[model samples]
Target chain A: METDLFEQTILPHLDAAYNLARWLAGNEHDARDIVQEAALRAFKFFGGFRGGDARAWLLAIVRNTAFTKMRAQPAQDLGPDDLDKIEDTAPQPAQVLERAGNIEAMRAAIAKLPVEFREVIVFREMENFSYKEIAELVNAPIGTVMSRLARARAQLREIILADANLRETRS
Target chain B: MNCEEVRELVHAYADGELDVARSVDFERHIANCESCAAALRNVRALKPAIRGSYYAAPDDLRASVLRFPSSPDGVRQSGGLPAAERRAGSWLLTGLAIAAALILGFFVGDAFLRRSANQNLLAEITDAHVRSLAANHLADVASSDQHTVRPWFEGKIDFAPPVEDLATAGFPLVGGRLEYLRGRPVAALVYQRRKHFVNLFIWPGDHVTEIRDEKPQRGYNIVHWANDGMTYFAVSEISAPELRQFARDFTTALSH
Candidate 1:
């Protein structure tokens, strides 16, 4: 790949790369460093990247970098698998804040999701990558992508709205 | 499509990611099912909430990220000089470098009296102030250990800026370092005089010195004034009163 095209097309996605890295790293400094390293790798391996979902390809690199860092770290605080444990309780946004509500809880909810579900949500919801692009990026069958996305939305809905008594408490 | 099928694509439906037939079916479901309509609204609200968390890498990251590209600065590097223009361009660069040195000497002469220097001083200072805020390194010289902080600058900077134990006074000396601010290398004297960061940038420059003392950009209260043979810019997000106090200590550190 010529440097010019790489500069124009792929370079534009650095923020997307950083956003994914920030989530993966769970901090600002590491996220910044991770994206730079990922960019270099992506730039070097630009030839291997097929066109279409540049966002996903970048994300894949970020995921790899994040995992590499994760492996290198000493005992890590592994958050619970949110997707597996669907609370029977319903979601309420306002009340979540006052009673044991924090940003990490919301983040943990997103983070705990299954990777398949997480990827679809991050791409579609966070990065705004479309189904076709996500399909291309993750190298998934479009049906799998669609289903994962569906599951992701449903899961998010249940988790977000799970604090059923939030409105009552707020009122 | 059935209601179940229509519901499955509500996200796509909301995102306009659906095609003609699918969109029609999804809308029909939404029109009939009040639950689906409310679900759509709630889901839509999640987007903006999520967006609130989207933070950009510091503005200076743009320079570092896009630096090597044929950026505006890159254009300057790759000067369009035919053989005839080559000499003119070389002279321009040389003249600029010379002018920069003379200008820098006028302002930063006292602040930084050094041997030869490398880099674009103005851009680096600007870049440093910005990068510091982004990196949370606005103060390079941070320490409760006054002895450690003061002597630390011995090997690093040509001058020994005073390091005082200001923790009791609410200003603690953080560690100091040599960093590339704007584009030129400068002494990034860091001190946390309370919650705010004091980024004291010392480098040699005259042309951009005038821009010093310019009104603070954004929330950064900056005073760019040249002294001691170097241009110095002290910046912080702290209020004008606090920053000025920090600046006073910053300049007083130059006490020989």
Candidate 2:
């Protein structure tokens, strides 16, 4: 019966779980391990699921699992302070338009973003998750999710424009 | 609303997260303010472009997650008797109980060993299948023609991946992609069966052996075999019988 509940509820969201883990862990190998661990943890606690939006519930577990894994390792990417600084320097419209359609650059910029900012962008932009859902998943208020998303976009624009400028000068 | 208020809510408005009355007021304000309108346009344009850049989860990852044992205690319990029963029995009946326990332990140990090994491999291939679909990175060289797709893998991988157009058999060739499995690069052939996508991972086998096994993992039907110096794994969401037909058709085409 427990196995049936797990297969029916948690198994369906494997792709979403992996996607969240990949972004958070920043690589495939770590993402794979984290997701496996997260699934086990979810199964152990499946009885407590309370039955509302299993995808979000599974993702919350994945998010927590990934963070725990990240904390165990030393810091890797830009810290939260760097994200806050980038937030202040909003990119111009011309800059964003100039970098439009540059998929590789856009991807690189997103990858470089601090985890907090990167996650909100992915949840909102890539996953098409709503503000409310994201708030609940990330365990933050709606306002925090909104502002983080806005800052993430701002940071992405800044990085893309800077990279484009660097390429232009080299040639 | 003033520019400051409008700038703060621009993302919310563009995302349709705003209440209806606030959205109307927001639109009204943006209609007059040029910068606000431009901000809204930029935010809107960012959505699809970003959405297109999805990172596919690796297939092995999916398999591992799917096959994750429901509970650690469940595995332990399935392997043997409860702790109290074992201790009591050990004291009461030494002769017959020892013999029975030995027989049961041997079978249980053998089954557990074989299961863990098979589970590892199944997890890897299933993960590859799920990753391809999730990442939307199904094919590196996508073509229906055997001529174009077959030659594409010549120098890219160690072996020539057999690219066959199985359209006549109802399994239409979609394309082929490069995948890494079991520490070696293998060819993953994509085929369409109805709306489902079948990922057939092929690699050069060590010897000539005709082996076939089927397992259903996490609602996916996975058929694996080794034949004619090449190992094949056909994985999909299709039914077991249908997937078996696919595997048979694929092997026959390659052998001939």
- The DockQ of predicted model 1 stands at 0.07
- Lowest summed lDDT over 10 consecutive residues: which window, candidate 1 chain A? A81-90
TM-score of 1: 0.44
Which segments of candidate 1 are over 4 A away from where they belong? A1-5, A47-56, A71-115, A158-171, B60-256
Worst 10 residues of 2 chain A by lDDT: A81-90
Per-residue lDDT tens digits for candidate 2, residues B165-220, read 89988999999866755434467899999999999999887655444556777788
TM agreement with the true structure for every prediction = 0.44, 0.54
CA error at residue A56 for candidate 2, angstroms: 0.7
Best by TM-score: 2
**Best lDDT among the predictions, by candidate number:** 2
Provide the lowest-lDDT 10-residue window in model 2 chain B.
Answer: B70-79
* Candidate 1: tens digits of C-alpha lDDT, residues B114-207: 2111222334355566766654544434556868766644433335554455555467767665564322224666767556667676666544
Instruction: Output candidate 2 Cα RMSD.
Output: 11.8
Clashing pairs in 2: B56-B135, B59-B127, B59-B128, B60-B127, B60-B128, B205-B229
* Candidate 2 per-residue C-alpha lDDT over A1-171 given as tens digits, one digit per residue, 9 for 90 to 100: 345456556755676787788778888877877777777668668889999888789889889888877773324553342223322323355656545444555667788888888888878876667999999877778877887888787767778778878888999
